[model samples]
Target: MATIRALVPTQLERRMKTPAFGRRALLAGFGIGALGALTGCRAEGFAPSAVPNGNIGSNLNIYTWGDYSDPANLEEFGRQGVQVQTDSFASNEELIAKLGATRGTSGYDIVVPTSTYLTLMSKNGLLEKLDLGKIPNLANLDPEFQDSIADPQNAYAVCKNWGTTGFLYDSTVINRPMNSWADFLEAAQNEASNNVSLLEDPAEIAVIYLAAKGYDPLSTDPKIVAECADYLTNQLAPHVRAFSSTPQNFIIQGSMTLVHAFNGDARRGYLEAENPERWKWVFPTPTANRWMDTWAIPVGVQHPDAAYAFINFMLQPDQALKDVDYIGYSTGLTGQRELAEAAGLKMLDVLFPPAEILDRLVSLEITEASGAWVDMYGAMQAKAGA
Candidate 1:
């Protein structure tokens, strides 16, 4: 099993800026690098170990999104004889790109990635197969999440939280309503003008462009991909204020009245407002994409059983409900949605999203053939920054 270590925030901040050795330095500081040296674990050499006497947290480690797993939960798990330590990553690509370069040296027991990259990671043998027997509580997960194609048959990943990508803004300034991706594109170009922005995620930007042209966001056809990139370059290039990875920051400052964002973030930000009544979420008659966050055991995890236990612990219906409510995203837990709705969440189709929009919503897929899309977006982002 991997030994635990404390995370140093200052060191992590500097490492994050270097672009080289950033991930290795962070993993090394977190004790994962030490485990790598002790075990000589290679990318293909890892296998699951026993549950470690249910003292799960004593040596358990998780690399996940910011603030998703609270200390109270860790304390509770510790009471059950499990001790958990956590680390955070700001984006899916950051985690993926880092882990890819690390060549499986990380001692992490779990990773939370959005669906597409989870699929990509699993397909590339970067994650471990889930052992269902270790996760009885996962029975409480939504049926829709089971057998999900992102990593079918419980092979790689488990859905953690889910939300749709859309726009949110002050209702007063917009006057009417923004109800489509096209509306946002035009608003950025003519109405909201420089006040609007989009998410900086390459996949997200691709989907946004695909949706604007009424094409499947996840289409594999080269012609469709090229068309989407060209349309985005032509329509959204000039008017965007910035391709901000964190739209909430700009929204709160009022410098950005409209920006493409995830649903839960929009809600949480509005709820935090001095005047919550002034803000609103625009699902746009056609939302661009519905996304899911997932938890998966990366290949070479030494403490496999503990990883499963952690996954099961989070999947408990009550736990799932609390987490989704706290994080402001919909849970894949079967009964949690109703609980959240009863608790006064507006619970719009926007959360589940409507079938028509869901059909249009594309799942981003990774492929060797995707270089064109990646290169195009990279160029667009550079130009946008310039």
Candidate 2:
């Protein structure tokens, strides 16, 4: 295990900006001095026309994935009179479970959830339908994110960021070409055990095995699910160093040479690490899970008005650009799309990927019975620990 050290934000930023250090390596192709400048289109300034009062007060509470947003967004919101409070969760299941447990009293005004959870939350009446009219910035969004499956008709959520789940590795550390799940498993067992980590999410773990087995990533049949569970418990579990919800730390500290990660995160790590030569990311061939995450106001939010105001603020092209630069995920803001692409692979293309790669992307078709992933993940952790 790697001992954790605390670094101030400035220290971390300085590290990430250095060519030999962090994100600078990922920028080798573009050679851009500043990422925020990547948004090629004119950034129309933000004006609160939709809200008559904007009496939303100075406080806004947000629940989101850990380390997912730009602190600059918080500063911008503060300038606009909204004090932002952000809480994070490890998985979508955690987000839904929290909201489900609290119901009307979830206390969170805004939450960033992926497409599936947004749809589920909407259907369960746990999300507030947006008055799209209030958010003129919606026009700035790419058509693909508008009126999405997660919030059909653009009813509840606004597009946040999107990416794919894969893994990043230290090529020099492993000293081998890891192209597919088969290679990943073999390396974990032989060269990388106790030095590699897999995703803590069972849906992702299942996708890895299912892809190796040539089954659909989102198979609904219980039998296929069972096979996935069997592979996870009987094979992958013993070799995995740990099941990490935020596995990027494994790559950062060099405790784990190979790590299951989201493409954006791997890219982020590559840009932030000491050894750029050691870092590499791959979307397992044949297929990978493509994901879209969105920001939504939870139903019965205490600061609904402020939530609207804050979201509108984020949707602005300039603000969205800062987020993509900081977070390394692709956004659907129309003005920022070209800029994001210019930011290059590991940033945009790898997150959104090219059209040919898009056909290989699969979305998880989870159902109520998907609780099995949660239990299985827990069991695997316990077994690994033992």
- Candidate 1 regions exceeding 4 Å error are 1-57, 101-104, 220-223, 285-287, 342-360, 367-369, 382-386
Question: What digit string (tens of lDDT, one per residue) describes model 1 on residues 254-339?
Answer: 66767777777666666666666666677665446567778888877866776887688777766676676666677778766578
lDDT of 2 by residue, 1-386 (tens): 11111111233323233232211122221122212211122224535437775455667788776666788777666665566777766445456657776776888898888786675577676788888887787788888667765567888888888778777877876787778877777776677776767765567777788887888776767888787887777777877767665566666676777788888777766666777668777777778877788889887799877787778878888788888888777777775657765655344555556777767787675563355555566567666623
Q: Which stretches of candidate 2 lie over 4 Å from their true place?
A: 1-46, 53-57, 173-176, 335-337, 340-352
Native-vs-model 2 lDDT?
A: 0.68
Listed per model in order, the count of residue pairs whose N, CA or C atoms clash below 3 Å is 7, 4
lDDT of the candidates, in the order given: 0.63, 0.68
User: What C-alpha lDDT, on a 0 to 100 scale, does residue 118 get in candidate 1?
Assistant: 63
TM-score of each: 0.79, 0.80
Identify the candidate with maximal lDDT.
2
- TM-score for predicted model 1 compared with the true structure: 0.79
